[model samples]
Target: MKPVADATPKVTKSEREWRDELTPAEYHVLREAGTEPAWTGEYVDTKTVGVYQCRACGAELFRSETKFDSHCGWPSFFSPLAEDRVILREDRSLGMVRTEVLCATCHSHLGHVFEGEGYPTPTDQRYCINSISLTLVSESDQG
Candidate 1:
């Protein structure tokens, strides 16, 4: 499904600006599509109720309610907040074919999504996203 949010992106920045704005780890994962070591991310077992937004551009990506423990060594979601909020592409890196998920607003790499994993999810898909690529806006903060 190629659901685009719009013809133009909502956020744009130069490489230097992105590097300056994000921390080294966040820049690597969010901007460079690097992965954090499994089971070491901050949100792996987190149960805090909140909306997860893109760390790079603060686009609402996932909600805490949809987060589930897939034991895949990363934060996993069954779906995004909305279809258009994320862009999925074929990632052929690491000698395997996988779907890469990115923030539709900024085009920043969030992580890979796998389908038919048989993880007991409603969608049968795992949105294996890097924790560093997201920021949790707790439900209390919504007010």
Candidate 2:
């Protein structure tokens, strides 16, 4: 079967425009598709109730309810808030084939997703995300 085409609208920006919008670390991960050091991400062990939004575009991506401690040294989510909120594409980098997750609106790289790890989630998928690529809006602040 053919892969389904992404329906999310594309976002276009110049390199300088992206650089100006994101921080150095954010630019590296979101724009350059780089990974932060394991266990060093801001949300790696965060356990607060909140909504995680894309740092680049402020689009809601994941919720705290879907987060789990995968012990993989990154903020892990079992699923996104909505299928259209994020996009996944095949990534063949660093000598590995993996599915890369990106912000659906901004096309900024968030991280990767892996399957069949036997996690106790609705889906057996793990979304390993970069903390720098997200912004958490705590439940208390959602009012």
Cα error, candidate 2, residue 89 (Å): 0.4
Looking at candidate 1, the ten consecutive residues that score lowest on lDDT are 1-10
Q: TM-scores of the models, in the given order?
A: 0.94, 0.93
Q: List, residue by residue over 51-125, the lDDT tens digit for candidate 2.
A: 999998889999999999999999999999998888888888979988899888988999999989999898999
What lDDT score belongs to each candidate, Candidate 1 first? 0.90, 0.90
Give the RMSD in angstroms, all C-alphas superposed, for model 1.
1.9
* CA shift of 24, model 2, Å: 1.4
For model 1 the local lDDT of residue 9 reads 69
Model 1: per-residue Cα lDDT over 1-143, one tens digit each: 44334346689999999999999999999888899999999999999999999999999999998899999999999999998889988778889878889999999999988878798878888999999999999999998
Clashes of 2: 0
